[model samples]
Target: MSGSSSTAANLVRTVKVKAEKKVYSLPGQKYAVPEEREPLRIFYESLSKQKPESEMAEFWLMEHGMMSPERAKKAYEKKQKRQKHQRMGTPIKAEISKETSESSRKSSNAKNDQRTKKRSLEYEDSDDDDLIMKPSKAKQK
Candidate 1:
């Protein structure tokens, strides 16, 4: 069915894949694409070579150059700035923590109020019984 008729969407998908493959290929480099390259695993291994926080610095140095300290420092600052901006404009774990704390505090306050109300009712009932008994005792005397 595909030999004679292909949809425009399929054609576009095919073209996009070919373009992506070309973009990923190295210029003037002649080698078959490796059959099994786990890029994510490789990245994790590279990061494992250093501490997690320093991995970004190591990557910038490797990609740019350790020899260029100014460039490295600038890149690091840029990376940090981007990270900070990203964090500034979004919900993070800290927000979740704060929300959880607030909700717990509200629940605890509600529970305490309920306990206080229940205690007040009990005291009122006891006071009413004492008042009634005092009147009866005085009349009997």
Candidate 2:
């Protein structure tokens, strides 16, 4: 029992050490040397630092790495244009053609008539007793 416990302790220690030393790398690259890893680390740091607060900021950041005055102006104009469209009230009734409106109304009326006919037919075929469900004998037992 003592020998077994010692063997387990040694195994646990070995596993812990190995786990601590484990390295992650891309499939083709077994291990990244300092030179290869440096550029990736710098790129990741830049990405982390350059997180934009909004769509406009994102555009500016992407174009110039940091916001430049010209890019900022363009981004601002784009944002304003989008906001203007959103703020515009619903489309005028005149913009929708009379033909489309009439066709839509006719289609909706036909659908409602079909639904009423189906419901009347269903009621005529079904009895009051059929509508009432009784408990199963197997379930009661």
Candidate 3:
């Protein structure tokens, strides 16, 4: 019953306020509410074109030897310093493994053979310009 009475009182107050506004002139002009700015189309477009930040960070790590940028820079600086020292001592020659040495020798021999064949062709040409002008063999009827 109390809730119903309170609701009735609220309704009467609302009606009174509406009637008062209709009878009396309200003070100040009602300004138009400003329109909201449109969503940023260009920002979305730019974001779509870009690689993901995490992927870019991973690429950056791989580029700098898979280390943190700071650590990579420190390592690079240390290497540069060591190189600048120009320490001279008995040079450590690289040891060629037997398998690698044999493969390399085979490749070298193949290259030499190619060169020899090329030279032989050149020599034949030098010996006679007509060497390459041999008549085609044909069975005479």
Candidate 1 lDDT, 12-43, residue by residue in tens: 65333444443322222223333235564355
| Model 2 misplaced stretches (Cα beyond 4 Å) | 1-82, 88-94, 129-141
Q: Write the per-residue lDDT of candidate 3 for residues 11-60, one digit (tens) a residue.
A: 86433344333321212212222223423333333443473333333323
Best by lDDT: 2
- In model 1, the Cα lDDT at residue 82 comes to 61
Cand. 1 Cα-lDDT: 0.54
Query: 35-63 in candidate 2: lDDT tens per residue?
Result: 43466545543564685334633443433
Per-model RMSD to reference: 18.6, 17.3, 28.6
> How does candidate 3 fare on TM-score?
0.30
Clashing pairs in model 2, backbone N/Cα/C closer than 3 A: none
lDDT of 1 at 78: 55
